[model samples]
Target: MKSAHQRFAGRYRPPSPKRSPLITPEGAAALKKELENLWRNQRPVITQAVSEAAALGDRSENAEYIYGKKMLREIDSRILYLQRRLDLIKVVDGLPADPNKVYFGAWVTLIDDDDNERHYRIVGADELNPSAGCISIDSPLALALIGKQLDDRVELNDLDRGYDIIAINYVNATST
Candidate 1:
């Protein structure tokens, strides 16, 4: 009974862009923790719930059974993604060769035209958290800053203004 557009609408979306294959050591640890939790704690509980709901009879009309099945599928999908991503990711666990220049895992300070200072860390895509001042290595700003020395001007895309690199430091991967 579904319309043609309705069927095609859900099928014709473009594929998502590929993510970078780099991850910080901390990020890798977090992913591993999540996978363990899902496998050890969450999956068993959801399986039990589904079994109990199915035992109540008439699964076709059982809301609990349907919801449990959906939740199980979601968890399984996430677990698979984490497993695959963890295997493919290369963890950056050491300092950059040159601490004076911008690189992966480097904390960078930039001064803008108005003398406003911004602090950011260039991290892997898996570890990029904007609220914590982490920028993905693939970002335009990070891309422009990489291999640049202190006091260098960074041109981010077509922005009329440029930011001057003020400082660069690399923290130990374990501490992050």
Candidate 2:
């Protein structure tokens, strides 16, 4: 039997669709580093603060104790999520078989009908940073660009917006 709270929680939030399990090597490394920082540094510091605060007086009124516990809970939740994500993800490294055509890790240059040029890299979801022009492979634009050759015109699923692939290059991260 489900409790009322459990029923309400389940009703309010539908389960999300499964995300792609691919991640770039750099993105995987970043996730691992974050997990290490949280476990080795932040968790220990918060645990110590909570213990000290609890020793001072009644924890019911101890603001420091309450806050420290909350911080610890947040950090632990993040650590668990990172661990699960890292376990599920497969890191994609090295260049694609066809460097001239767009694939994962390829930097694509596109020209809109207006002749405005834009550059985007199709990376795994974990590596997406829109400000840096790194787009997720699952994104509509990236999906549209996949396997397309240079000068190939792409019509997106969205209404009427299309782009011409001007260039495709797989820039090795180690290369200048």
Candidate 3:
């Protein structure tokens, strides 16, 4: 088991997600809803499951109890994470005046010379879910794409792969 000091002490690095003071009101509401649901619905459900399993006695041999406790702890950890994130976040409640530029919350679509297309949204590192189409603003791809406008191609040298990708298409957030 990790010491309590190990878990809570030391210099804390804030999450690397782009702190945008601008976000769609919808996004903010969604985060709030998730936080609420985790605390209310999921928290109690997992606790109840653990209680029922513990009632079986002999916790040392109780698989259900051990797993249930682990899961409940995981859920609680996630809740704490979300709470901290929500507190640091500056939710952009509306679109910025400069929609033509790439910034936090802007959905960008990039096309390679081969016409292969991929879309990404630059957001905070905490929100970096590739499956959800969100990429961290601190990432290499987003770094390459930032400030680029329509028809302004970006050439990225993937050093390890010894290949360069030529960006042929760019779509700013407003257009997408």
Instruction: Name the regions of candidate 1 deviating beyond 4 angstroms.
Output: 1-6, 172-176
Model 2: lDDT to the true structure: 0.88
lDDT of 3 by residue, 1-176 (tens): 98887887786677865544434444667778888998999989989999999999999999999999999989889889778767776665445566666666677667666677776777765566899677877777777767765555667677331112323223444554
Worst 10 residues of 3 by lDDT: 161-170
Worst 10 residues of 1 by lDDT: 167-176
| Candidate 1 clashing pairs, residues 3+ apart or interchain | none
Give the clashing residue pairs of candidate 3, or none. Answer: 17-124, 17-125, 18-124, 22-92, 23-92
Separate clash counts for every candidate: 0, 0, 5
Q: For candidate 3, report its TM-score.
A: 0.69
| Model 1 C-alpha RMSD to native | 2.6
TM-score list, all predictions:
0.88, 0.88, 0.69
Give lDDT tens digits, candidate 1, residues 97-169. 6778787888888999989998898888878899888999888888888899999998766777789999887
